[model samples]
Target chain A: MEFYQRDRTLQPAGYTPIYKTSVARSPRQAMLSLQGSLSETTGPVFGQNELGPLDNDLIRNYAKDGDPIGERIIVHGRVLDENNRPVPHTLVEFWQANAGGRYRHKKDTYLAPIDPNFGGCGRALTDENGYYFFRTIKPGPYPWRNYVNSWRPAHIHFSVFGSGFAQRLITQMYFEGDPLIKECPIVHVIPDEDAINRLIAPIDLNGSIPLDTIAYKFDIVLRGRRSTLFENRLEGN
Target chain B: MVQSLDYLKETASQTAGPYVHIGLIPKQAGFDIFENNFTNIMADENTRGERIIIEGRVIDGTGTPLRDALLEIWQANSDGRYNHELDRQKQGQIDERFRGWGRAGTDFDTAVYRFETIKPGVVSGRNGLDMAPHINFWIVARGINIGLNTRMYFADEQEANATDPVLNLIEQTERRKTLIANRDDSGPVPVYRFDIVLQGENETVFFDV
Candidate 1:
């Protein structure tokens, strides 16, 4: 059991026709890579009796009477694995667009304004060393049609998993100094500027909470597993 | 295992956009904030074998049908094992009433995506070879900037999809009929179908796992 493959040059470039819906959604053939079997070294565990102590609290999980108007933050990090190890218990999930970029979704017609005490989304899990956090509110900058003024930057959409199913990922975090993450055409279909600076995130005033919330961090790596035998137990799960 | 010149480099993938169902199915975008939601029913009437259903449609490249995708699947349980703890620590069997993982979504007006699960058996692969029953999908949507992986096999297994070492690693035997899936026993159970295209002409073969 030694799987570890994904690094398609740190991905993103499957027909980046300036990200206009990636021009008919990429894939003009030639993908088939294979090798990691047992369905890519197995995945799907998420226990903690299937979450919900407000599942990582997206600012009170879906508050209605008071708390969800803007700038609260948190985010946090860890889930590592390109050999920096620590992938422990993994599943992260997240979602955004409130403080005013709007998106309570019914196809977000934009024009920002839906905060009836926001309900954006959340979920966490990591632990046993691979940390995880959540909290939320900061989400704004949105406007997309991919280019007649395409704006999207205050990101946050995670969705990790990562303890193999080929360490699934689904990214988007960006927020450090967002110059719209350098004019994102979907973050310029990553031709890697250090993999788009590891999807941004920064601002961690020592995991903030000074006068209530404001942190950021955002680490995540996922896709690396080795085994050979540490008393083998079925590829050392 | 030496790698790590300060490891970390993986992140970059952006575009589960058009509000990915307000974050992966927030009660299918109307947000009831998940109190146990993710469904497509991964087996239940006391879980055990044959059942089936699967159905599909992720289509795209002008053929339309993507009602914002979002799939997820993983299989095994109907005896080829895997409810995973490395196959329950090497097959000490498990079907603790099966929930072999599912999560479906597409149908915000029929971009169709069904699951209902069961039919999984034959597993083993790589060196031990077997692997025919298949299943494992993963998809993701809104202009999908990443997350695609595939595999669904089984058109009545046709002699185990012809010695399926991941369909003999496709080297184009008519593009391995884009990972089979046909079946259709007309109703009550066995459906299969499996569409997933994502780009020009017969696409669906995606896997880089």
Candidate 2:
């Protein structure tokens, strides 16, 4: 199947002058010019047989015990290709902070208390319909050292693996109507307002289980560079 | 408000952060969710070709080793064929035991990553030219917004490396050496040392794909 071609403009320019560290090692003109010639090599060959059923649950680490200490929520969505086709059996991994805004990581110096019940990580493979669902808690906003008094908006990190090596994407999904989104340097790096809006997942009441859990829908669209329209089109013929 | 009236733009990229290791490889991160690493080995004892070791450290621009970097490698089997359905159609038989994909996180203390696999054979490149035996590498770390894509070629395969379509495409001859892993046969097993420098004068060539 023909996948979406790589779109240079839609991707963040490596040496974005705004992001400070980007200046240090970001590719210069020479390296940027060479990237166009690099072709897709071997893609991954993963299948349902290679996966386990328990891989999908974020709360599975505490399965033998009680629930994790947080607001229970279900995050569900489909993994679509650039052509709008469902990508089945692809791996979708997630990592995020606990409801208290603290991570289970060692380097995370956030002062919030760590919830022993929450492991804060999970993985799920898309089904035949390119659909995946995660039983996770609502992670809280956390502070970072990016700048003085800079607190990252409540967000979950997502890593999606498509059919080929070129299709791999790592992005963060923010909650809808988060006030912190406007101040986020990472989110603003995209340069396109519409694309930034796409990263926010709307609250899906329909997917919620009434009293037990709330649900958020986040559909990921993999890169497909088939559509390329030039600027300044002639007046409608 | 000027609207482009075109396709949807691709999503923005972000760093893998310090939590990537905890999520992906819980065992390595001390969580111990799984018994073994997600991708500890690419090939088994029954796999074909000469067994080799690829070891290297990921260094940042400041010359400090990136301890948080997570790396994943995909390559062809000893027969120059991948275990995927597409390659299997072309090469017929594939080693059942060879997964042809492995993942390793940089050691917390040493900041070095290692992978053990057999030597990959030449594969057909773009326009039917013979490509060099190379292992594809994907690297992600704290400061890296997107995963860096690169390839590791063999230094001993000078004949094959000379005609490699991808290597030749590199206009600068000196920059091409960054992709070739120098072979050290002095060890018990053949070792190929390929250090990846994220930035600086000897920054490894990272592909945009």
Model 1, A36: alpha-carbon shift in Å?
7.8
Q: Per-residue lDDT of B56-147 in model 2, one digit per residue for the tens?
A: 99887777777888898888777787766545225325778787888888888998899998898877664456678998888886667677
Model 2, CA-based lDDT: 0.76
Candidates in order, TM-scores: namely 0.34, 0.90
Clashing pairs in 1: none
Best by TM-score: 2
For all candidates, state DockQ relative to the true structure: 0.24, 0.33
User: What does the lDDT read for residue A54 in candidate 2?
Assistant: 60
Cα lDDT of model 1 by residue, B111-178, tens digit: 89888888888777656666878888988787778888888888877998888777787887887897
- Residue B196 C-alpha lDDT in model 2: 90
Docking class of 2: acceptable
